[model samples]
Target: MALIITDECINCDVCEPECPNGAISQGDEIYVIEPDLCTECVGHFETSQCVEVCPVDCIITDPDNTETEEQLRAKYERITSDNG
Candidate 1:
């Protein structure tokens, strides 16, 4: 599943750069995760990089965008290929 930044976010700006898929960005209020680009760090790390660096623990799995590990991997591959 993609991760979503909750209103509890402090906007500390730590999670944006940590996202390997460039999915996290500054929203009107807090940071937002683009579900299309998020891979939950599947191709880049053992765990979610954003979740790792978040100070307030405001990041959580987006139930609305639920995806399996295999699906995340496929999305990662697709994103990398588009960039490469």
Candidate 2:
């Protein structure tokens, strides 16, 4: 699944740089994760980099945008291909 930043986010500006997909962005109130761009770091890392760096643990899996590992990999490929 993709990740979502909760209201609990402290806006410390940590998670944004950690996201390889550039999915995290500053919102009106908190950091927001774009589900379509989030691959949970499947192809880039063993775990989610945002979750690793977030001090408040405000990032959580987005149940509403759930996807399997294979699907996540596909997304990663698509994104990287666009960049290439």
Candidate 3:
């Protein structure tokens, strides 16, 4: 599943740089994770870097954008290939 930054985000600016997929960005109010670009760091790390660094713990799995581990891996591959 992709991750979503909830309204609880404090916008401390820590999560943005930690996202390997560049999925986290400063939204009008809080940091937002783009579902298309979010793989939950499947190929890049054992855990989601943004979530690890977020102080407020506002980031959570996006139930609305759920995907299996295999799907996330595929997405990671696709994203890396596109950027490579």
Write one digit per residue (lDDT tens) for candidate 2, span 37-56: 99999999999999999999
The digit string of per-residue lDDT tens for model 1 on 2-76 reads 889999999999999989888999999988999999999999899998899888999999999999999999999
RMSD of 2: 0.5
lDDT of 3 by residue, 1-84 (tens): 999999999989999988899998999999899999999999999999998998989999999998999999999999999999
Cα-based lDDT at residue 36, candidate 1: 99
lDDT agreement of model 3 with the native: 0.95
Best by lDDT: 2
Model 2 misplaced regions, further than 4 Å: none
What do the candidate models score in CA lDDT, each in turn?
A: 0.93, 0.96, 0.95
- What ranges in model 1 sit over 4 Å off? none
lDDT of model 3, residue 9: 92
CA shift of 65, model 2, Å: 0.5
Model 2 lDDT-worst window of ten: 57-66
